[model samples]
Target: MIAASDADKWKKALLEWDVTSLEEHPSSDGVCVCGQTGLLWMYTITNDANGAELFPIGSSCVNHFGRTDLNRRVDVFHKLALVQATANAGKPVEMTTEFFSRAALKFLFEEGAFTPDSYNYGDGVNDYEFLLKMFGKRDKSTITSRQGYKIRKLVTSKIIPFVLADPRVR
Candidate 1:
């Protein structure tokens, strides 16, 4: 596990520079734990040779990550997974950390889960009330309301059907 101090330092360094030098090979192709294809960008900590470490930064990194097209392909995979999961569950499943972190934003966007206006949610009151209502209706045995909202929005949206109808999720 990366220490908090180290993580913070890395974050600071990343913010200061638009790009970092490749200490070694810049990228590697692999499958994420969620089964999605991922490009792991490697970086080395020059400050501490004693504590030298290698880490896989996510695709969001400007450099060393996969091409934009590959990221989009991976996003499609994530959306398909969500659709399959929802269909198999026979009900809308809540979004878990596993879903968001592993899933692609494009899929969420296509599913109407990510709308510019929807994200606004007005102000504190509307957002809080919506959250409260969702919480009240949540299935205690499953995931939390926060997770449910994300999953449900995506499932209900027409985007999944429009985008993936060829595969026939049902």
Candidate 2:
């Protein structure tokens, strides 16, 4: 427990705590230690004059803490995943889909998007909704070019231009 007098310091440190790791999946079969199952894995730096500690967190906890950057990164990851899927479909791989996705992912990876980099879970909520609208399926891999060619219009007109303007979320 933090000392009463140290409350401010703890809050400040928490606001600045670096993301040490992230995983798409949980280590346990399903439940987070926090007891929620099937959530994103996030690890934080726990430290001070006393030394250091590490904690595993879920999206709910991160949201509770108001960590906007963490949330934003997750958003960016979902966007990147979509960009990659579009690339696989040859949407704009020859244009900017491949380049932007690669660069965006590299930026996140360098910032510790995943420690030991695991995907035990999967893409976040925003990604699911977006893909569902475009492909009628959650897994982009299952989409067929013949069936999805018209979806390319949406990608070319919206997503590609969106990423080109601000790849990591404006």
Candidate 3:
């Protein structure tokens, strides 16, 4: 077990960056190689001592050992995992955390879910009541209300999968 006070020693021993984040693996059973044991994706901590000693650490240990930035990335990956799981299940994911992350918002734009008035529009792209922050709004003015409804249904069911790997409907 590494004590927090020894964190600096660990940092000083690193031949490379003090920390490196590994993407979460699909198997939750993988053990964290830090002195602590349990399932969490592994992080590689490499040190030059004795010709480069490397070991894996859990996401929690990243912060506990003073690698807060890596911890944030771990959180982002956790959300991504949730989104992917929902997508694989063929369920419709909303724009909430379970559906997507802020980092992933650009996917909708790239997919042409809705074109913003400008690049800097941010979350103001479309604010439909139930679908606030959703990728697009059903434009009734351009299409009749009935057509808009049908399009929404089709987009929610079909276009969404192509727009994002994550489910895009309730």
Off by over 4 Å in 3: 1-27, 43-56, 103-170
Arranged by TM-score with the best first, the candidates are 3, 2, 1
Clash pairs, model 1 backbone: 95-147
Model 1, 22-71: lDDT tens per residue? Answer: 21122446433224354543322222422443343333443333345435
Q: Which candidate is the best by lDDT?
A: 3
Ranking by lDDT: 3, 2, 1
The TM-score between candidate 3 and the true structure equals 0.44
Error of model 1, residue 152, in angstroms:
3.1
TM per candidate comes to 0.29, 0.36, 0.44
For residue 155, give model 3's deviation from the true position in Å: 11
Native-referenced Cα lDDT, model 2:
0.46
**TM-score: which candidate is best?**
3
Model 3 lDDT vs. the true structure? 0.47
lDDT for every model? 0.40, 0.46, 0.47
Instruction: Please write out the lDDT profile of model 2 over residues 7-107, one tens digit for every residue.
Output: 45756655644334343442434444466666544444344444454445555655654777666554445455456455546656322333334334445
Quote the lDDT for 33 in model 2: 43
Model 1 lDDT on a 0 to 1 scale? 0.40
